[model samples]
Target: MDVIVIETPQLGDRSYLVHDGVVALVIDPQRDTDRVEAAALEAGVTITHVAETHLHNDYVTGGYDLAQAHGAEYLVNAADPVSFEREPVTDGQIVQIGAFRVTVVATPGHTHTHVSYIVSDGTTEAVFSGGSLLYGSVGRTDLVAAIDTVGLTHDQYASVRKLVHEAQHDAALFPTHGFGSFCSSGPATGAGSSTIGEQITTNHALTDADEEHFVATLIANLTAYPSYYAHMAPANMQGPGPADLEVPESLDAAELTRRLADGEWVVDLRNRVAFSSGHLQGAVSFEYGNGSNFTTYLGWVLPWDEKLTLVGTHADVEDAIRDLSRIGIDSPDAAIGTEPRALAPDAPVASYPRVGWAELARDHAAGDVLLDARRTDEFADGHLIGAVNVPLHEILSRMDEIPAGTIWVHCGSGYRAGVAASLLQRAGRDVVHVDASFADVESAGMPMAEKAV
Candidate 1:
């Protein structure tokens, strides 16, 4: 038997496949179908079962179309009393294929209908845990009406116990979401798989903490769900077809400028400090605590729902497009992939940073001005002693205050710094978007000023 996991970084989601001999089952597919279809063909198998762990809030699921093409049956936890065209898999139901016997466990803390599947292939095995369990944490219990406060908290506790208690000793665990996930608990893990004993032994959520403390800690650390979540839930619940897959090309610098000047808001997904120094004049930043942070936020932040002309330091654009497409905003023509075009003075001037951190420090000490592009709270905590603070989102109106020098800019981390560097470099400014740890020169060890108490 073979199990494949597809991680979609764009929308903070993942998909799973369980195969035995020529038969297979896929769970929580991404909007793009090509990735999964290609996986099946390469594995030398025929897909026959599509199972959704739950209604997703991050991106649309392509389970339906995949099931249709392969003449497979699609399954969801029908015990929730919800309606669906495919067969409803209930708690304790076992799905047998070749040497694999997948037993459905009703693990519903994240949602009323959510279930975790334990796949035993008669060997050291794994569980198709969906959102029920993950590395260092668990799923968020806040997805639409399916979430009942007391019920969910209680259910989540029970679910955690069931997964830990009822699971086979040797079964490894896999979840649909992980860190940076809008619906996942976090230590921001990037782990692909772990054993049930591993989670119980190491996962903070499954540790010695009592149920009450567990629930309390979960609620406190949880960030609010993204705006696009509402849309994604229905699309997945209805079993939307596979995403029309495509690898989008990113736009070159000049074309990116043209698109922005024409009204598209560049999203600087990079971390803080780096963003502080400089970025496209009007790019929307996700380095702060406004909840939604992934490229999926592009749907909520983009002006008038215009097609994007994306620019990022990473050469891979497929994840970005997949992230965008998950919330129902797919466009193969969205980006212009890197080939550097020229932008005029009137063009919108967002840029990605090309300078390294060490060089930034040297420029800063050489009398180059350092700027801090972070939220008011982060800037107020501690920044480079002489650096200026201008949050990325407010750059347009505050552009007037920017000093005319060889500016060395920074954000909390480096992503924003890169964007700022890109824009400034394109504008012919001798600006170094500093990706190092910089401060707005408050006292040491402070957070955003206003957010402090």
Candidate 2:
């Protein structure tokens, strides 16, 4: 059997297509089913089974729709209260598709009903540990509910041990999350590939035999996840339809200006440097590129169900749509161009000054507000003495809380700070983008804050 991996790097997740040269089984598919369908076609295999480890808390699942489209059996946990029909799978249940045998194992941690699958060809075995056993860490246990977090943490510990005991030491380990996904308890080890044997000695859950320490460490390390995650589970339970990848209607200069005037979200998809140099007066920067996390940040900050207008080139707009579609945002209005000036010829553009850590330290001002756009934990670790900690995701809701002044926003690497700076600038605050790495703060001669004893 051959395993094909379909990676969604934007969301830090993977979907797999496992085949026995004739029939295939797909696991944890994203809303876009076309990619999986294309993979099956290229491999000359018919999809006969599709399985979901659990109701996801990050993106809408395409399992229900994909099964219907291809006339495949949809396998979902028996305990999940989903609205669609599915082949109810339980712990220890074995299924056969062509020459491959699949075993379902209960591994509740990421969610109450989460499970993992072990697929074998009688000679070689591969384990699909969706959000359970990750590269180094395990999936976060708090997404289900705050009340169940402690219990789920313990469950996660047992689940990881269970997986290690059940799967062969040399079995190929494939996880749906932990590739830079927030679902991971902490930073993933960034391993491209691993096996059960490799993870045995390296994975934190395995190396740290103390269950209480493991649980406490995971809970303490859990930072703020995307606000958009709140909607994913409900949408998945109701059964999401196929993703609508159609390009949104194009907006002319007048329409773009009107939308801006009306205070709609007109996201400018350019690099941070270009965005800070020039953009539409009301357009906020959400740069689109590889490893940008464009969808995650945008989805987290923007109000749900609001009219969104994307401004960028055709390629950027198309790519943004696909990324947003994975998170259930579809049919957004679009304005294609190299910059805001070209998109809105008749309109006046806005620009902000970009500075570095050294410059900020050199031009010391008493009244200026230093806004730290990193997460809360990051700020607590160490930051500039007086920098206000307003994470990029919370910039919108907590706008009024930021002290009024010439706001100099900075993040760990300035990517998030760029987004925060544009939003502040659009909100009529005198903003400057500190486009420098936070690592240089001390070397640049900036004063560091001390932690509370």
Candidate 3:
């Protein structure tokens, strides 16, 4: 038996394609199914079944459409009240695909109806633990509802223990969340691969036996997730089709200016340095590159279903569209170019200063405001002594709360601060992008404070 890992780095999730030479079982596929089809074709395997562990919260699912396209069985939890027809799977049920035997296990923590699959071909065994049992932590429990948090926390603790007890110690443990995903309740031990035995010895959910303590810590540590997540489960429940991955309608300088004048979202996908150097006056910065999580931040901050326009190089614009489509933001208008002046010839180009913490320390003044763009929990852990905390996600609604003057902004890293800085610059505030590591705060000799417990 061979298990293929399909990673979605933008959302920090994985989909699995498990096969036994001739047949494959797809699990938790994303909105885009072409990649899955390509993997199946390359492996020379027939897709016999497509299964979903639970209704996903981060992105749309393609399981329904994939199964329909291949004339395969679409498996979903029978307990879930979904809109479409499916081959409903229940706990302790065994499903056979070619030489593989899959046993479904009920592990309801990530959601009320979540399940995991243990596959064995009488010799090799693996567990596909989606959201229930993550690398270092379990999935966050509060996504279901605020009132059900405590109950789900207990369910998560038991679910991890149950999965470990049921699967063989040598069974390869593959989880769908916890690879830099917000779905993870806590930090995932940066392990590329893990086994049931390794997770038994290392994972917090299994190692810590005190249920109440685990519940408290998990609840206290939960932070805000993306605003875009609210629409995902509903869409998934209705059985979404494959994403539309076409290139956006091309816009010239005049059309780009018209969109900006109409107050449509025009995101600049350049690095923070280039963005701060010169950009179209109204465009917000959501840099697309090797390290930047352009999809996550842009999707989180933008209003859901709003008219979004992309301004960047043609390649970058195309990449950004693909990334956005995975998260269900599709068919945005685009203006592609290397320079802002070229993208919008007649529009005035705007500029801002990008600095480091050291410079802020040297130029420390009486009234110059320091803005922290991290989440409230991040701000509480430690922040500049006099900085205002307006997380990037809440920047639009909380604009009035930010004090006027030359505001210097920073985040844990500078990525989020770049987004916040762009928003501030667009709002006509005197802004400076503190584009440096937060680790330099101590070396820069800046005053810092921790929220009093």
Residue 300 error, candidate 1, Å: 5.6
Global lDDT of each candidate: 0.65, 0.91, 0.89
Count: clashes, candidate 3: 0
Which has the greatest lDDT? 2
Model 2 lDDT at residue 294? 91
Model 2 segments beyond 4 Å from truth? none
Q: What would the TM-score be for candidate 1 when compared with the true structure?
A: 0.72
Q: Tell me how candidate 3 scores on lDDT.
A: 0.89
Q: Which stretches of candidate 3 lie over 4 Å from their true place?
A: 450-453
Ranking by lDDT: 2, 3, 1
TM-score for all models, in order of appearance = 0.72, 0.98, 0.98
Task: Say which prediction, candidate 2 or candidate 3, comes out ahead on lDDT.
Answer: 2
lDDT of 2: 0.91
